[model samples]
Target: MAAKDLSTMYGLSESDPEQKLINRAGMSASDLEQIDRIMAEMGRMRQIERRIMRSSQEFMKLNETDMRALRKIISAKHAGRSVTPGELSQYLGISSASVTKMIDRLEAHGHVLRTKHPTDRRSQCVEVTEETHLAARDQVGRHHAKRFEAASRLSSEERDVVIKFLAGTSDAMESSLGSPLDDDAR
Candidate 1:
């Protein structure tokens, strides 16, 4: 389709300063409404995830920040990556000193362990203990696994488009807000 036709499909027009480029280019109101509905569903999913996380937090007897830190560790391990205090600090967008205190708290609670970095003598990596790891998996893994299963139901072409769209939206939001992951830290 021509760019003009494409623009008209999305409800863009000259009067919308916020969407000037899109306007200049014609978005149909119906397309805009559809986008809004998709975004609303995404928000609903986020709410459900938060509820699941809250349940896990209560079970672990930890506050939001602590749970978030643990999640970062879990996510890193899942990705075959070792997370350092410094990296955690970056993830949390906090000072290294604050990260140390959080790490200390987790260690004191037997949820985490500190060890020498395999290749870096001067640095250390944090790991979640096996018991804690299992607990975390039990807490939130089901929802994640279900989501994975849902993804498996998609055709490759559909998955590729969805992956690209998700990445594009995330990147666009980060670009607009000048923050990576938005309020994901907490």
Candidate 2:
């Protein structure tokens, strides 16, 4: 596999400190092969994600965090709710100061807006702009449409298999991490 592909698949870069450690760990050859296949498929999925994010960044001049913030705000607005900086901090697993900087950058770029909260004048609500929503529909949403089409084309049995596999994988990951997957932790 290409170096970048390996890195993306295993969440490692060129200077992985744990590579040697993992290599010497006791495991059967069959077990190693299974792990290899799983990483390869995960790498393929990362490529698909790269396509979507790159298109969104090119269209909106935003980074991954900015794109995520916009998506979250849009979701909240659609749900008739508002997002605050503290909530975003908790959701994104970042510090409040970092969230402030993010909010400032997005607001300056006209991607998000900060307005007074209805109940508390001292607090603010963050929301995605209409222009960003339109841009998302044109870029990232188009990518999702293609993926949905691909999924739809799968046979019922194939889809069921995929669903079960994904669900089991998600559960395994959560158990390994000792934490539940938060809805806003994407």
Candidate 3:
């Protein structure tokens, strides 16, 4: 499609609200190209991300719900906070009862611990056990090492550029979308 046609599809005509907004912001063709490049890079990155996630899930032998819960627990723990089942439910947008069930399974498997909440007598906080911590660290390290080994086949500068671009792209995306996994909602 022509650039004009493509832009129109996105509601970017001269008379459209989007064009007026772009004009007020003084966006140029290069800026638009940068946005386009970033979006294209995002698409490629998503494909790679999905493959990596699938491979990691397979390596960990985790199903969808288990993986989701584990990720929430690990991420929260990594941020130095014990997450309540209710908080996890809110974060995952699931029912609290479902989170409770998942937490039970995780606790039973020794991956997580449920303890009385410090401030709430009726609530419990979920904490990752040492086993979960060690397992995550080891698995991530192996996956990263493998990815690095593959990248090493590229010229040093190319590898560095790719890594830098991906990091920057990730940061930009996180800033734009508020979360890395937000796109997964679609």
Candidate 4:
């Protein structure tokens, strides 16, 4: 097919830069459909995330920021890493001072511990206590299991499709916006 014909098939205007690239690459309708599906799935995932956040707030009695910080710290410890306030600040897109205050509160609650960094003499590391770990595991595990149980009414194929669709959506979004969970700096 001619470049113009292929671009028209993909619904790209002739003057669009993407249209020029697509014409050079010869994209398919299935590719366009896949992109559209991914975009739609992303919207659905955001709605699900919001609902989960709301449910967590109602059941856990913790604000979203606190819950997120706790979850991040727990995940870091589960991965065998000591989390730093700076890292949490970057991950949460908050100031380091705010992260320090949050850590202090968590420490007071006996949910976290602050210790000297393994290698850095000047920095301290935050770790979840065993008690906190167990509590977090039980709490989050049960909540998620219940959520999945409710979802289990769907057939296996339908569940697989949902998982794949969400995974693809997440990947596309992560590609567009850098992953907030990645610990690039300690």
Give the worst 10-residue stretch by lDDT in candidate 4.
Answer: 1-10
Q: Which pairs of residues clash in candidate 3, taking residues 3 or more apart in a chain or in different chains?
A: none
| RMSD over all Cα atoms, model 1 | 6.9
Comparison by lDDT, 1 against 4, better one: 1
Model 3 lDDT at residue 176: 88
lDDT scores for all predictions? 0.79, 0.80, 0.71, 0.71
TM-score of 4: 0.56
How far residue 30's Cα lies from its native spot in candidate 1, in Å, is: 4.8
Model 4 misplacement above 4 A: 1-61, 146-160, 170-186
For 52-131, candidate 3 gives per-residue lDDT tens digits of: 77776786676676776776777777787777888788777789889888888878878888888889899889888887
Sort by TM-score, best first. Answer: 2, 1, 4, 3
Instruction: Decide which is better by TM-score, 2 or 4.
Output: 2
lDDT of 4 by residue, 29-120 (tens): 77855554544454565577688777766655567777778788887777888888898898888998898888888788787899999999
Model 4 lDDT at residue 167: 74
Tell me the lDDT of model 2 at 30. Answer: 74
TM-score of each: 0.71, 0.72, 0.54, 0.56
List CA RMSD, all candidates.
6.9, 5.6, 8.3, 9.1
Give the C-alpha miss distance for residue 91 in model 2, angstroms: 0.7
Select the stronger candidate by TM-score from 1 and 4. 1
